[model samples]
Target: MKVKGHCLCEKVEFSISVESKRFDACHCSMCLRWGGGPALTVEAENGVDFADEAFVKVYSSSQWAERGFCSHCGTHLFYRLKEGNFWNVPLGVLEDRNSFEFSTQIFVDHKLGNYDFANKTKMMTEEDVLKAFGAET
Candidate 1:
């Protein structure tokens, strides 16, 4: 399916093709802080192609992850890692909200104390997450 996404201000938009079942939610600390919870991330092998550079700003969140957002509105765009070329796009940013479904949950160990996952989404550790994407960190 062709997944379409845009920033909150609509200044930045993008399109990518991905399998529905490949979508995942990440509960890592940086992801949680970035999205205020689990970051609904989908791997785009082709990476994100920005509609405009005026709105997109990148933040080096860590040695492993760098976050991108709208410079005008601060809308989180994508989270990137050096080890993986795939851009992790947030599901909430998609124009077609129902275009994807949660396939798995990563970093369950780092998830918040009050929240718990009820669905059948597979939970994995930091190692599993990094290994899945071939990331060392």
Candidate 2:
């Protein structure tokens, strides 16, 4: 499905022209710290465009990861890195959030004990996540 998303203030907006069901979440420290727990993420198939450059603040959170948020309201948007060739976009920022089906939960080992995903989602260890993404966190 075609998905469009914007920041909390609607000043920044973007559209993704691909199937949204491919989105996933990550529980790694960097992602959790930047996005307040599991980061709802997806790979922008072609690419994403910013409605306004000033709307998002990019923070280099780690050696391999960086995060983006709305500067106006501090709405966390994405956690991305140079993953070979693809960039990870936060699924929550998509306008049509329901279009995506959250399947796997990555980096379960680094997740805090207070939070849990014991229902049905696949919980992946750091090694498994890195292996699936073809990179190490």
Counted clashes in each candidate structure? 0, 1
lDDT of 1 by residue, 1-137 (tens): 67788988899988866766367888888887777888887877678877677888899998777889999888888888766575888877887767566688988888889987677877798888779867665
Model 2, range 23-100, lDDT digits (tens) per residue? 667887877766667787877766667767777888888777777788898877666664544566777788777767
Estimated TM-score for each candidate: 0.88, 0.83
Model 2 off-target regions past 4 Å? none
lDDT over C-alpha atoms for residue 108 of model 2: 79
Stretches of candidate 1 off by over 4 Å are: 134-137
The Cα error of candidate 2 at residue 26, in Å, is: 1.2
- Residue 57 lDDT in candidate 2: 87
lDDT of 1 at 26: 83
How many clashing residue pairs, candidate 2?
1
